[model samples]
Target: MITVKAPGKLYIAGEYAVVESGFPAIIVALDQFVTATISPSDTFGSIVSKQYQENSIFWRRQGDEMVFDNRDNPFHYILSAISLTENYARETGQALGVYHLGINSELDSADGKKYGLGSSAAVTVATVKALCQFYHLPMDKSKLFKLAAIAHLSVQGNGSLGDIAASVYGGWIAYHSFDRQWLHLQRQQHSLTELLAMDWPDLKIELLTPPADLRLIIGWTGSPASTSHLVDKVAMVKAKQRGEYQTFLQDSKACLKRMVQGFRNGDLATIQTELRQNRQLLQGLGDFSHVTIETPILKKMIQIAETAGAAAKTSGAGGGDCGIVLIDRAIDSTQLLKQWAHEGIQRLNLNVHTVNDDVISKA
Candidate 1:
């Protein structure tokens, strides 16, 4: 048996703007993960999840609004990973074999509620990693990330693949999305193996090291947000307000640039300052788009964190899920956490998972 795990991720600064080609976001890999375990099957191959009682036929709409039923599917992401990896394997002159794959996730609450910790991204990366081991394929970090990103985008079809980068590379990373338009154009002409080796324009992933005095605090709002839904809402509304959307993208790009520099220079104060700016930017964005980027509970959570002398903001596409706080190590967070507890907020016990840490650990 072979088991592999990929860590979940949170967007520390850039959120809505990261979806644009070449736009940047700062994301960190969290301790929670999705694990994929695979073993050879002599008779029939199957995909299963510990969260589901049975493996059922899966279906979803495609570009032309056509629905297709696939029996091998247990989940969209896991199925995408399996299909793409096998395609890649065949493109590389490798024969296929049957296997049974099982998935388990830690990116959710005990009751099976999502934490919005990029569960799909983690699972896709984990599935790809596990299959690589099963096939005796050698892949470096970059290659693995490219493969996982492709698989994820095939299913989700939106957003920046920064979560995929965070899962593959681990730890703090400054990610700029590649040009999906260019990718779409190339897909018509290139094989899976060819696409993996090609240069993806504007795609950048830089690992960052946090200052020693910087402290990151995460608070869960007990509500899950659909990132795709939020992104779609913004897109629909932003069409009518192109000028403001453009400015938001430029400002976000510059803010994340400074935050990345802060990490490089060990400047905790600048990092916090930029974080506050990012929060305000996101709020303005939410206001303009009329989408609840920060729900009432998340807003309350941020207000408390800021009162505690920390810079706070909604972590991902907002609506709900988790908020992140950046504070100096010298500040006392006791009162802040106490107040959060009074409001039913749960502080998550999560830390950065570095690339040196295990992206795929054997069990």
Candidate 2:
């Protein structure tokens, strides 16, 4: 049996600006992720999922055209991965058969089907890695990353592809986009992994779970706002006036340079400043926050978070699924968490992790 686990990611900086400015964006592999286990089987190809119970067991034959069981289809991405697997096997002349594959995700926490933190990407990476291992496909990291990217794009239609890259590559990533193409650049002048593994500085972070008393308020805009669509729109929006856009681009580039330096220097204050400024620039692009996070409820929540002295921003796709809030040192995160609960906004205490340190036990 072969197993693979991949991490989720959070974009700390360069959200919308990364599109227009082609600026470098920083991301961290979160502790949350999806796990896949594949076992060789001759009886039949079976699939089980913890997330979907009833439809978990699917029996099929070798080279049989796999059909998705809509009764418990998590998302179209799963089907895309399956199709890719078949195509890859046929193209590479590998024997195609039913491998008893079990797929599931162990997230830090989730509010049902909330669309934040790259769950789809996690599944895609896990599936791709599992298949690669099962077939013993000698693909390099770049090739594996491309396969994952293709599967992700099949579903999202448009995404930065940074999430998949970070999950597969397992490290802090600097992402860029050009001519409608996404680029994942290597910029680990410093690695949190090497630092943590070596136990250089005992990085101390207080990951506080929001008190159970508070309800995290999440809303779906019911609008399918494509990340690429929003990003491309920003490009078109900024093109009408070159000067302002160029200035924003230059500021973003400078901000990214400083942000990287801050990470290396362990200067949280500078990082926070850059992130705050990046958020402002994203807002200027007008496609920064997703609809759900932009609603009055979310606006009030951010205002409340600020009033309670917390650093907050929309997580993931922003038109909104989740928000990450950092409480002030002097403030009790739990106390503020309770207050937000009183206001009907949900809070989550999540742990941060570095690539190749937390998950990615094996490729």
Candidate 3:
């Protein structure tokens, strides 16, 4: 049996802007992860995920495709991962055998609420690694990131793939979005195997070492966000208002630069200033796009963090999900937690997964 683990992620800054080409976002891999275990199966392959439900999906190879026994399955990501990995193997002249797969996650609430911790990306990365191990395919982090990205984009047509990168290579990362327009056009003409084989030198993914004194607190808003819906809304706005969108992109780029510099120099004031400015920028985006990017509850949480002399902002395409707070070591964590609890924000006790740590481990 082979087991693989992938961590979920949080975007510190550059959320909507990172969707544009050449814009960079700072993301951190959380300690929480999704684990995939693969072992040999006699008749056919099966997948069981506790996070999805109590159902098991049994599937087998049908010509070149993986046909699951159930059609209306929620675990489309697992199927996509298997299908794409199979295609990759065949294209690279590798053979694969049947295996039973089990996926478990620690990135969810005890009562089954998702923390908006990029669970889908974590699972997709874990599945790709497990499939690679099952088929004895030699894959480094970069290759694994590409393969997992192919599977993710197959299921969900749009994303920056920052979560996928964070999952494959655990740590604080500065990432630039890939050329989605080019990828979309290429997908129409090429297969996933062909796309993965191509080189994408323009996609920048750099691992960063954050300041030791930097402290982070993750607070869940008890509401789930549809990232696709938000991304599409933003995309429509960009299509109609290209100049305005460019302004947002430029402003976000400047903010991200300052934030990165702040981290490097241990300048808490610069980091805090950028975080608040970026939050205001996202709020402006919500107003411009007519989509509520930041909800009232998320705003209140940020306010609470700010009152305590910390910088807070929504992590992702936030209608309502998790908000991140960055503070210095001098701040009172206990007092902050009490205030957040009063505001109905659930604090998630998670730490950053650093680059020195292993992303995939034997379970």
Candidate 4:
């Protein structure tokens, strides 16, 4: 059996702006993960996952659209991963074999509640990693990320692939998105193998060593938010306010620069200050789009953390999900977690997952 694990991620900063090419975001991979295990089968293959529900699926991409082999199957990310990996395998002249692939995740609650931990991206990365091992394909971190990003894009069709980057690299890293528009055009003229080998325009990934004194804390609001749904809402209104939106993007870029610098310099105060600025920028974005980026509960979550002398902000799209806080190690977070619990918030115990290697191949 070949097994691979991809860690879930939370955005530290640069949410909406990261979607555009060349904008930077800081993201961390959580200890929670989605694991994919595969083994060769004799007659046929099956893909099964016990997440949300137990099921399996097969699919193919028709140009930019995903065409499900089984219309009732909901696991588009896995199917897309299978399709793309097999394509890459054939392109590399590997003999494909029937395999049974199993996926299990720790990114959700035991009773099946999502915590907005970027499960889709994690699963996609996991599946791709597993298949690469299954085929004995020697893949570097860059190729794995590019392959997973293509599969992920074929399904949901939007967002910064920053979560994919975090899953691929692990630990804390700075990411800039590649232009999907450029990829779209290049797909018309290039082969899958060639595409993976080629340099991506505007895409950047750099590992960062954050301040050792800083500690990460996550608080869940107990209400899940649809990342795709919220991103759609923001995109719809973004065009109507072009000038203001441009300003928001610019400010976001500037804020991310300072925060990244703080990480490099081991300055917790600079990081905290910039995080607060990022929250305000996201709030202004929500105001113009009339999309509630921060709900009452999320706002309360941030306020509580701020009062404790830590910096806090909504993690993802933020209609209702998890909020992240960075506090100095000297400051006790016990009272902070207690206050959140009193307000019905669940404090999640997650650490920054550090990867010894981008992918582990074990049999």
Which of the numbered candidates is closest to the native, going by highest lDDT?
A: 4
Report, for every candidate in turn, its global Cα lDDT versus the true structure: 0.88, 0.58, 0.83, 0.90
1-363 per-residue lDDT for model 2 (tens digits): 998887777666666555442456666567777888999887888777767553242334557677432312344566677777566655667788778878777642332443356667788888877887787665555556666766666666554666776677655566654323322221124232221123111111111222222222222222223354445455565667567677777887788787777666656566666666766665554532222325454555666666765555554546655555544355656655666677666654445555442322233
Residue-pair clash count for candidate 4: 0
TM-score winner between 2 and 3, please give it: 3
Give me the overall lDDT of model 1.
0.88
Residue pairs in collision within model 2: 214-341, 215-345, 215-346, 216-345, 216-346, 217-346, 290-318, 290-319, 291-319, 292-319
- Candidate 4 lDDT, tens digit per residue, 1-363? 888899999999999999999999999999999999999999989988777465444467999998654322337888999999999999989988999999999998887778999988998999999999998777888999999999988887889999999999999999999999999999889999999999999999999998989999999999988887788888998889999999999999999999999998999999999999999999999999999999999999999999999999999889998999999999988888889999999999999998886345432
Error of 1 at 229 (Å): 0.4
Predict model 4's lDDT versus the native: 0.90
**Candidate 4: misplaced stretches above 4 Å?**
54-74, 358-363
The TM-scores, one per candidate, come to 0.93, 0.69, 0.90, 0.94
**Candidate 3: pairs in clash:** none
* Model 4 pairs whose backbones collide: none
Residue 91 accuracy (lDDT) in model 2: 61
Taking the tens digit of each residue's C-alpha lDDT, what string does model 3 give over 299-349?
A: 899888888889999999999989999988887778888988998899998
Residue 21 lDDT, candidate 1, scale 0-100 = 95
Ranking by lDDT: 4, 1, 3, 2
User: Which stretches of candidate 1 lie above 4 Å from their native place?
Assistant: 53-74, 357-363
Report lDDT (Cα) of residue 6, candidate 2: 77
